[model samples]
Target: MCSCQQHSTATSVATLAPNGAISFRVEDMTCGHCAGTIKQAIEGRIPGALVTADPASKLVNVQGSADFAAIKSAVVAAGYTPSAEPIG
Candidate 1:
């Protein structure tokens, strides 16, 4: 007997967009290391920040109340270009 039920094996990316949450498109983020670096950079600057980075998409999402400028600065400090896509 074979199971015919369709199931999703793909892992969904959990992005929390609470108040003050921000997402930035990072250029030069080519691998997991880059993602980890970016995550660390932001978390270092803003304690209690939850950062999720997808290297494949070059998108880093931060969930915290940190200042926007500080987040951008952290990206720059990590040697990556931060491109903010305005959310309407």
Candidate 2:
């Protein structure tokens, strides 16, 4: 099982690109269903947005016109906590 319980809160942990692509880490999301829900939530809110969520890596990337705040909210709305991957 993915032990991503270390981070249970949503924090400002995303990178917004010039093209509006976002890449962030969601610590509490640890399964295909969790990823699917997040993907659906984001896509539903932002039409034409491409969202890729990987449970194994705990990373979620969004390619479309979505701000950092919006993506974070979507993850939270899906019942997961998003955060930045801890740096070494």
Candidate 3:
């Protein structure tokens, strides 16, 4: 019997807003090191960017003027996949 759950928990979803806020999924972040890496990667790419990552929610919220492409790239560079939809 396959005991794996096919459902996605709150920690596996990310929400990005049109007001320069981004939220994405990250499953490997377990410590401060991961947070720092993610922040640095995003800030480095977005320049004056603000990011708040909730490991519990697996969501990374970013606020800045960076474009969606850049933001997506930053998230990928940080070792996470950016979701398709941008939350309002």
Per-candidate local distance difference test: 0.67, 0.71, 0.63
Q: How well is each residue in 1-88 modelled by candidate 1, as lDDT tens digits?
A: 0122222222223232555577667756767777888888889988888988897876788886446678878877876667643252
Residues 4-61, candidate 2: write the lDDT tens digits: 3443554545655455567788866777877888899888888778999997987888
Q: How high is each candidate's TM-score?
A: 0.71, 0.72, 0.64
List the candidate numbers ranked by lDDT, top first. Answer: 2, 1, 3
Clashing pairs in 3: 16-87
lDDT of 1 at 84: 47
Name the regions of candidate 2 deviating beyond 4 angstroms. 1-12, 16-20, 84-88
CA lDDT for candidate 3: 0.63
Error of 2 at 19 (Å): 8.0
In candidate 2, position 77 carries an lDDT of 78
Candidates 2 and 3 compared: the better one by TM-score is 2
Indicate which candidate wins on TM-score. Answer: 2
Which 10 consecutive residues of model 1 have the lowest summed lDDT?
1-10
User: What lDDT is reached at residue 83 by model 1?
Assistant: 69
Q: Give the per-residue lDDT of model 3 (tens digit) for 1-88.
A: 0122232322344555656566666655545556667777888888788887765655667887537678767767776555655555
